[model samples]
Target: MNHLISRAGLGILVAVAVVAGAWARSGSGSVTAQAVLTGLLLGGVYALVAMGLTLIFGVLDIVNFAHGAFMTLGMYATALLATGAGLNPYLSLLVSVPLLFGLGYAVQRHLVSRTMGGSLAAQLLLTLGIAMLLENALLLAFSGDTRTVAVSFDTPLRVLGAVADLSRVLAFAGAMGLAGAVWLLLTRTRLGTAIRAVAANPEGASLVGLDVRRLHALTFAAGTACAGAAGTLVTPLVTVEPTAGELFNIIGFVVVVLGGLGSVPGAVAGGLIVGLTEQLGGIYLPGQSPLLAVFAVFVLVLLWRPQGLFGRPA
Candidate 1:
């Protein structure tokens, strides 16, 4: 009951911030509308990115820092297919998704699984090392060059008197659909039930004959796959560089923290809030980095609800 109230309160607070920001920037209704729409679209991608991080943490309790790198890898893979083989970027998902899934599985099974129940410091170092290795490998392959995937439908669309790229709109729809699928998977599937059981009590789950290690690998793989899909989705919207994922990594962490550490719904809500705060911040502070607004909101939320809006009181 208290959790419900906390969630509602946080929602109200974030909504107020949005309203206040919008009102403050009310000089041009069209610009405000544009920002709001763009922010919501961008937030969908953010939510998808954070969802994977939150899922890994929720089920395996592993802070996988390499998640964004996995995302970058996906972008590169999609780009490669698009540029080299004349394949549609969206169709590359068939390859990128499985590629990331296999890589994530190997990472967890061969490296991360060995560190389970061990030192958190060691786990952090391991994931950090993995991130560095992946980034450097990408640098070697892609050579620090900025790349983009070309799509046939790279045009503009109007919504509510505001103009947005077709790619952004499609990305937004795809992201929301994927997020909903994930939500259903967690709520209405046997695999999800088993995964949740493992999350609740790994030892007890093991005692009950569930293969915890396998589930951990599966969870990590699913998480990375989510990152990969998000990367592919945004390939048209952003430039692809070896270090591109670093910015996303930072944002993912902020979203994960701003949301609950292990809550999927929280991550989604946080992503949208961050996105809105960033876009609106551009209007409120003309010359400042939009992230400044994100941090401000994050700090305010943490100060008010340390465990995050959806996180259980610890």
Candidate 2:
């Protein structure tokens, strides 16, 4: 794992150097700076999404195909509160987070928990069904129209000669702050200790008098809450559509695999790397979609480190 992380780190540095060199040769230092800045900010959002995902997988050992659906639900929840109730989008987190958390907990306790210790295929199908159902339900309710929350701080901020949207900066800061808080919860709190214990050894946790099922439900709910927070944060930056969660779903998976299947900090690192790859790719591959570049990096990383950059080697 250490060696893999080192190699990954080296690859990131090399990637940065190459992108910087390309931009320099093109005499577009400002454009390069802007891409890097944009990528980092975008990466913060990705980290927030992926952190929830990693946490769920780490504890529940289930790949939540419906995770993105939860995010879309969050987006709509925030949108409804902001537009209907005249609440600030950021302030909507209070409602969105708890609502999603309760939904997640109920889903896990009533539905997902049944599939535990069963076939992996069963879990996949269940989550995929949930994803489809939630998405279609959203479409029925809101139609395909794109909704957005307008914010006052849409102005651009200058950072080191590069321009960034103020909203994006705020979202980035919020993402980092939330991620840090989650990290602290995991490392410091008793519930966190129980969650970690369950992740490490469910039988052992059970033997230690831990209510494993409750912890699983709580962890899953916590993960969904993170998704809700992310949805709220990005409400001002992106269009809110039923299908809006699809892109985040794809990126979240990429981040999960790249960072390691179950590492929280790894998700953050992977998100930044993916973000950089996206922005730099736009500069280097002028005609291709930036996501294409992200996939290329994903492929290379998978080839070299299937356990992920931060995952323990088997």
Candidate 3:
């Protein structure tokens, strides 16, 4: 079995356990366990969010500020289809993934491409506009009502006396599988080589007559598709409201920045770090809960390894 934590990762895990053991000694063992599990699983969700954001920033040299908007689009679409059209929750991936990929591709080709090589201010402003448009569009279509996607309205699963919704388990599994696949693609394929080439040296790739523009479109589309898939997975657990992507957007960017700009593994590890920080910190500290720990870790990470845990030095 793959180890749950790495040696370096284990050190932090141990520190968390020590503090949580204090809580458990006070009759909070079960709560601590639940928090650990929650952190591990929520890490998977954050992994999904960061996978794409890092990819775009890594490959295209564009910070996609609107990634969360595409994520919101996925969540809303899944909610609409699973609840309104009566589609099976799992099967909705058949539609949501492709539909959003196409949208991402078109947006990149027309809007993002136009702003390529421009000032960072221009790119940020444009994507921010797109994010605003998507959120408002969702508000208009759904009337700001909360919606959700789930298999059965009231069936929660019991595992070893811990109660969790089945959909959440499925979401965690789906996110892991997807992240593994993306890691493989980046490490094991020719297209992956081309992507790394561009990320490493865009001008050199252009000298070889590579279709840099097309690759950018593909990379952006793929990143947004990752976000869409994550949304489809998590819509079941969270409320699918217009602003659903807000928190996720903030954290996802933090993860990418923490993980390093272009390193896939950094993104994944950074996500797990965020997940554990939120859960363990919430339990031990209780008052400030997730944020105090999350930002603390973020700053520590940047201070210790400014290039990110796995990101290459720029």
TM-score of each: 0.95, 0.96, 0.91
Sort all candidates by TM-score, best to worst. 2, 1, 3
Q: Lowest-scoring 10 consecutive residues by lDDT in candidate 3? A: 1-10
Mind giving the per-residue lDDT tens digits that candidate 3 earns over 1-314?
13434646775777667656646754676677676677778888898899999999989888887889898888888888987889877777878789889999999999999999999999989999999999998889778888766677546776654566677778888998999998888889988888888888999998998889888998899899998988888888788998898788888977987888877887888888788778888875767758778888788877887888665565
- Which candidate tops lDDT? 2
Please identify model 2 stretches exceeding 4 Å from their true place: 1-12
Candidate 2 lDDT score relative to the true structure: 0.90
| Candidate 1 structure quality by residue, lDDT tens digits, 179-279 | 88888998899888888999999999999999999999999999999999999999988899988787777788778888888798888887887788789
Model 2: per-residue Cα lDDT over 5-95, one tens digit each: 6877897789778777758755798888888899999999999999999999889988899989999999999899889988888898888
Positional deviation of 32 in candidate 3, in angstroms? 0.7
Backbone clashes for every candidate come to: 0, 0, 0
What TM-score quantifies how close candidate 1 is to the native fold? 0.95
Please provide the root mean square deviation of candidate 3 (C-alpha atoms, Å).
3.0
In angstroms, the error of model 3 at 230 is: 0.7
Error of 1 at 54 (Å): 0.3
Q: Candidate 1: lDDT over CA atoms?
A: 0.87
Candidate 3 Cα deviation (angstroms), residue 123: 1.3
Pairs clashing within candidate 2: none
